[model samples]
Target: MRAPTPVSASLDDLEPGDQALVAEVSPPHELSAWTAWLTSLGFEPGEPVRLLSRARPGGDPLCVRVGGSTYALRRAEAACIRVWREVARR
Candidate 1:
């Protein structure tokens, strides 16, 4: 089977109902903030996340539903939000 395609971007780029796992963080320095915020929402480094909605139009906050909870994150805080295509799961 083929591996999933990776899309690297900030969390704000994700669309509603989109699902993906946290891949790598760019620069690595922002790991602490990312870890803390994600951990609070039950999103571990390798856990899957489902995009629920964007906080506001053209805003940096992205509202994502992960592990039955919703999380709002700033785009800059999550600098390297990588996601895989759901089709690759099949």
Candidate 2:
């Protein structure tokens, strides 16, 4: 059987209304608090995180949905997250 195509993407690259699986999460810098904080928010590998909305004009704070909860995250914070699975063309 053919294996599923492996794809990688940064969370911030996702357009509005996109959904992806959290493949990895890295902090902005070594020993950054984001590493621990993200984990607490269930931002772990294989977790389903969907981009719900973004701030107008410039996308800064993003609205994301994880599992059943939604979170408002900064663009920089989202950039630290990597996602897998090829997003279907919209």
Candidate 3:
């Protein structure tokens, strides 16, 4: 059988413990200021990334691991990063 196609989605869509690869960083028009900063944080295309967890009460800030660093990003900020979901290996 042919392998399944990979799905692309915003980083915020990843569940805790899920992993994905950085696909693109396209912040909305108003949030465009963060594009360069996010890329500097290793959110560039093809980097490995993982969703660590979400804040309680409201899942506003999401903890994510990119490259060798960990960062807490607001949901809106996380949404600026597009990612390709990584399938778990057996």
Q: Any runs in candidate 1 off by more than 4 Å, and if so which? A: 1-10, 25-33, 87-90
Question: Which 10-residue window in model 1 sums to the lowest lDDT?
Answer: 81-90
Off by over 4 Å in 3: 1-4, 87-90
> What C-alpha lDDT does candidate 2 achieve relative to the native structure?
0.84
In model 2, how large is the Cα lDDT of residue 45? Answer: 94
lDDT per residue (tens digit) for residues 1-90 in model 2:
455565789888888887789998886676489878987898999998889999987988999888888999998889988987563343
Q: After superposition, how far is residue 80 of candidate 3 from its true place, in Å?
A: 0.6
Per-residue lDDT, model 1, residue 75, is: 70
Query: What's each prediction's TM-score?
Result: 0.61, 0.84, 0.90
Ranking by TM-score: 3, 2, 1
C-alpha lDDT values of all predictions? 0.62, 0.84, 0.92
| Residue-by-residue lDDT tens digits, candidate 1, 1-90 | 987656655454667777777664443574556655555556556777777776667765777776677767777654555554344535
Cα error, candidate 2, residue 70 (Å): 0.2
